[model samples]
Target: MTEMLVPTELLTGIAEMDGQHDRLFQEMLQVKNALLAVSDDDAHGLALLSRLADDLVRHYAWEEAAARRYGVPFADHAREHARMAAFVQAKIDEIERGVCNIPALMVFMERKFESHVAHFDLQLGLALQAARAARDAA
Candidate 1:
């Protein structure tokens, strides 16, 4: 009876980023569960979704800032963040448009997270790790 949005094994070797990934996954899972629960209180579900959106915005911002600071030469990495932000916003909009299909949204999130982790998340994490090592040795 464990509810996890993204498996911990998906987290790469960066500590702060991995912690953020875990928190984001756990928060999204909580929101999905609350939305699917047989309860009359929809407020908690709404709040969690809002918080997720806010956290995503902040996380993306911080990630892009780090890339800039570290001089990561991958242009696709920043574009990936923009693409994901748009996708996530679109999902949130769909949910807010009187759609109660939490199951469908969860599926979409799972697919999105899988692709994102494999691509942009891992790239950023690896780049940051390299950057940190270089800085430490210098």
Candidate 2:
């Protein structure tokens, strides 16, 4: 099954956040493409997954920093970030141990990405937008 590209509509209005989102979208697309091209190559999928996880870490770090700078209630956001990061890391660990399910992992990631961006990231963007407006008004 083919995964859809991350929707552009989800891009946050903040430039740094938006740039990170764009890069993640591109990286995810590349990973999905690589997966499609090498269904039988576990090593290839593993490499792509590792890179994807690494990119996500970088993106989350940048986002968390922005959240902190904007004073966006880091407690809840930090929990969400930790959960997502752990999910990806757990899968990678399982893969390393030769007990991972690649198809299931992809499905989980695709669904998780969609739901996460829709709920968590959307709220983050809205919060950032509100904060920016408030700063501007002041």
Candidate 3:
């Protein structure tokens, strides 16, 4: 699997979140590669996809916990996460039914992930940083 560099714009300035984002990107790349490979074993690709879905769920839970700890408003963020999870599951179903366009699906997922990091996650990161700074200053 080719290593994908997380763009600087995607960095949330929170170490753990950044690391998770990196891992997620790598996992997505692996899934894309596996699907694109000219092999009869699509089982490997499907497994990778399932793992990516699971990792995303864990990542979302971690972020939600951090948001609560930092006192960031989380209802909207949690709703967005739920929507994304549902979308991923639907896509996985499509893939399982052999109706997926692998490249397009990968591209869409990558863009959606990047947009979420930029808009939602970055806001949460900023809130977390401010909360920590305030606590330290007290």
Best by TM-score: 3
lDDT of 2: 0.76
TM-score sort, best first: 3, 1, 2
lDDT of 1 at 93: 80
State the lDDT of candidate 2 residue by residue for 1-138, as single tens digits.
434345766755666766666666667666666666755666776787888888888888877887888889767767777898899889889988878776677777777776777777878888989988999999
Task: Please report, in order, the local distance difference test score of every candidate based on alpha carbons.
Answer: 0.77, 0.76, 0.91
> Per-residue lDDT of 1-138 in model 1, one digit per residue for the tens?
555445665776776777677778887788888888998787788788888878877877777787788998757766877787787777778777766577788777767866777778787788889998999999
- Cα TM-score per model: 0.84, 0.81, 0.94
Candidate 1, TM-score vs. the true structure?
Answer: 0.84
Indicate whether candidate 2 or candidate 3 has the larger lDDT.
3
By lDDT, rank the candidates, best first: 3, 1, 2
* lDDT, residue 46, model 2: 71
Per-residue lDDT for 83 in model 3?
Answer: 93
| Residue pairs with backbone overlap in model 3 | none
Error of 3 at 73 (Å): 0.2
Who is ahead in TM-score, 1 or 2? 1
